[model samples]
Target: MQCHQTSFTLSTAGRGPLRLTARVAECVRDSGIHTGLCHVFCQHTSASLLITENADPAVLRDLEGHLTRAVPDGDPRYTHDQEGPDDMSAHIRSILTGSGLTVPIRQGRLALGTWQGLFLWEHRAQGHARTLVVTCFGTAAS
Candidate 1:
């Protein structure tokens, strides 16, 4: 058994999904771990990770729109607005989504669905730098 870990930072343009499939794959390849698991984690409370469709932009837009409707900013019921209207909402969005995800590694690469892609979902209204920690564990490739 083998384990490897790495971390990287990404700047989000705010309130959208950023593709991370290729970057994560690089980490997996570097780890030399085959037939294992790759876990990706977001360090921020307001941002989350997702594995969704990467083929069409409309799917992302629609998901974001639905989240906006479900977790609208400045709902008036939230009191943790220390960072402005979007602060609490961002936290809510993160909770609704998640903070990390795990994918399988096969043949020293991510064994994801053909259309699946890893994404960093920024729930804030302003751009900010986000850090991600990726850990890969399994048998080292021969």
Candidate 2:
């Protein structure tokens, strides 16, 4: 069995989902893991990972809208607002979602559905650089 790990950095514009399937595929291609499980993790507490539709922009927009409504910034009831209104809310959103995802790798490519894509969900209001770690574990083809 072989294990390969790589990290990529993405600069998010704001509160939204950033598609990263292509980047992750490139990493998997470079890793030379033909068949295995690829674990993608976001090394942040305010952001999360998700696998959703990539064929349409409306799907992402709807998800963002729903999250916004579910966790509004200021409610006057949050006491952990020392970092700003979005601080605690961002953490809460991350908790509600997730921080990592594992996808199958086949033929040196991610085994995602036709419309499925990996995304980094940025819950914060400001633009920032986010890091994602991609780890591939499997047996190399002979």
Candidate 3:
């Protein structure tokens, strides 16, 4: 068995989902792990990871809209507002979603459906650099 790890930083433009499938695939290819499981994780409490539809931009827009409606910012009911309205809401959104995703790799490619893509969901209102870690684990061909 072989294990390889890599990471990349993405500078997001405020709150939204940033597609990272291509970047992750690049890392997997570089890792030399032909057949394995790839784990993608976002190292942040105010962000999350998701595998969503990549075929349409409307899907992402609708998802963001739903999340906003589900967990509205500036609710005034939240106690942790040190960083302003978007602070606690960001944390809540992250909690509702997740920070990690696992995908299977076959023939040196991600075994994802044609319309599925991995995304880094940034819940914060301000743009910032987000770190994504990609780890590959599997058996290296003899």
lDDT of 3: 0.92
Please give the TM-score that candidate 1 achieves against the real structure. 0.99
TM-score to native of every candidate shown: 0.99, 0.97, 0.97
Model 3 residue 74 lDDT? 92
User: Which residue pairs show collisions in model 1?
Assistant: none
lDDT per model, in order? 0.96, 0.92, 0.92
Best by lDDT: 1
Cα lDDT of model 3 by residue, 1-142, tens digit: 8899988899999999998998999988888888999999899999999999999999999999999999999997999989889999999999899989999999888899999999999999998899989999886655
Candidate scoring better on lDDT of 1 and 3: 1
Error of 3 at 106 (Å): 0.6
lDDT of 2: 0.92
**CA error at residue 79 for candidate 2, angstroms:** 1.4
